[model samples]
Target: MRLVKTEKTGRSVHWPTIAALAFLVPVLLTALGDAKGAEPEHRPLMSFEYDPSSEVDVELVLAVDISQSMDTDEQEVQRAGYIAALTSEEFLNAVQYGPTGRIAVIYMEWGGVDEHFLVADWTVIKDAATARIFAGQIAEAPLRQVQRTSITSALTKSVSLVNENAYQGLRRVIDISGDGPNNQGGSVTKVRDHLVSAGITINGLPLMMKTSTNTWQAMLNLDHYYEDCVIGGPGSFAIPVKSKDGFADAIRMKLVMEIAGLTFDRPSFHPVADRRPVRCDLFD
Candidate 1:
């Protein structure tokens, strides 16, 4: 992965090269058909080597923010955090203790409705080597798009991706990490409610750090906005990483909680005064 300095923001971020995979003509045809609003294509006859029926306990999908606000430095930290978590001994232990000793994840970057890119899809990490390969692939993929933050789109697409997996896991989760609130697309509250009701847990990593003294107040304001509208479902909670340095710790903690399926006592950190529950009715 090459770290690139953002010209506009003067921040350095790691940019990874894309890996080329052999394309099957039939698969391409199915994708084309789906794009044309035809009937949904049937599942592929081929499958990954990993055994999904071995009772895998958890399936985690990470939805990361690659919006314009996240400068190169911040994005690098975010990417590194996930890489470290996936390769960590603790995470592996959690996976092994489960029935299948496996965890499948889809790495996606999202900004707005039209800006979701699947960097990696449903890679089952059963060993250290597999985990490293997944991480390396993520590190090499370039940032696909940049727009406004749309937490709703990320959550919606994530739910769809997880359902597409054939793994029979005990738990399903969508880990969403963002440094800003939803300012694009439809209402986030509506999407949040719909996903939560579908029995998918939604956890959040909200970056509250300020890049400049002038942006501190604005960042703090947005943090509160996230606490209200962006997190929900069983064991759902938002952990604030006050700065880039805290990214690793926050990510580690979130991963452990997800693997263990731990529940939170309450939503403790409220950054805004309108500490009301996120209600879709308000927007309607």
Candidate 2:
């Protein structure tokens, strides 16, 4: 059974009414990285002079969904996949290739409009040892499920988290992973557009392992929804996970791309560039 609790904000947003609200035009984003298909693993690490002002190369918020729609088994797979990716050789190598060789990360879970929980606080990971410690904390943390899906609330909280954090980075990114669309809280497209305007990049991981026609929340072509409505800003992209086994690989690839600020030309990687510009009324 899914748990229900009062929202901490003490406010409720009607989804239908909120959806009707006008959306701001999104700012065009410049693509990051070069045309050469340079994989992070193959890139050579270069020495960087440490600037006290910029502590890390990127500040990343890993916002994962924990709504009742995701079963316990699926949740475990999701959690495990992150752990594996963080400790993977590719991720560690990518960190070293960065100018700072360090990145700040926050792992958070969200469900309803008010159900954003911080599983792991902002931690700087520069090497394998620090990465292991961060991964260990994630592995030890308990998982809980809340009712409803609210990508809007999650993005709102992510922006706030980035603003509140002390570490300054060359890039700010929110890596959002979810299985459903926003059926609660305010309009996701509005919040996404706001983030893009503020120069915050948003990437997405659309979990499609359990897509079904019977489930109301299990949306089809979720990757399209993410690309067209959820993600924005420079170098924004969405990678859909069609099977349970693809989670780790997809996550590792996304992290490497974000940390190294590079994009691969592989077919599996979907960059939101050179396509139609994102519109506010996508879902409607």
Candidate 3:
């Protein structure tokens, strides 16, 4: 979907709200140390160096799957793909379009209700150097244990992050990348409905590498599941990567489309009429 260009002045940036207690409380507590009054170790403030004068267009949250279904090799491929995209020249070209065309990405791994960790939070990548650093950090971080796929919880959490931040962008999107169907927590459709109603877009990247003889059938089924249950908002679409080798290209393509706020002319990939059921192979 094309993002509507909106005028943004300094006053409209919500600096006061950004400085409010909700954001400041943690900083204050850390600076003051524990209740015993001992000096706490110093840490850098969580802020980005992007030029605010440039046009701001998109805020994206990447909710990645780390469920037990994805083995270590698969996890490595996923992580590497993102890192490569961050450093690619194509991504840099995408960032230069707007005055301050910045993409604030929050990298998170989600499985079960209790198994989401923020590997990277709200980092703005405006230049190639910064993007490379962010990618390196992501590459070095250890993959956490997976539990279950909770599409509803991940969507809810991503929406909250975007709402809390002050972004003068034309579009807000949640990019969910997973390899399995939702089998835990609340209904995925309900969450998608709520996010759609709030004018937020949800896109899906379903990984379909592990299916046996029915690989194509499994992908078709998974695509249908995502369309019916997880994707929403204007111009939302799902792009499936049939194998690990396809991950980098898929992500790069999606990023380009998203950063440009481009609309999809063709209909999104939907399931064929006679697809088979997704056996609970990952869960069992």
Query: Scored by CA lDDT, what does every candidate get?
Result: 0.77, 0.84, 0.78
- Give the per-residue lDDT digits (tens) of candidate 2, residues 191-220: 999999999999999888877543543534
TM-score of each: 0.74, 0.75, 0.74
Q: Which candidate leads the pack in TM-score?
A: 2
Please, what are the lDDT tens digits per residue for candidate 3 over residues 118-229? 8887777889877987887898898876778888788888988888876656788999998877777767777788899989999998888776655654654676667666
Q: Which wins on lDDT, candidate 1 or candidate 2?
A: 2
Query: Whole-model lDDT for model 1 versus the true structure?
Result: 0.77
TM-score of 3: 0.74
Model 1 C-alpha lDDT per residue in residues 195-224, reported as the tens digit of each score: 889898888887777645537436345455
Judge candidate 2 against the unseen true structure and give its global Cα lDDT, from 0 to 1. Answer: 0.84
Cα RMSD of all models vs. native, in order, equals: 26.8, 27.7, 21.8
The TM-score of candidate 1 is: 0.74
Top-lDDT candidate index: 2
Model 1 alpha-carbon miss at residue 90, Å: 1.6
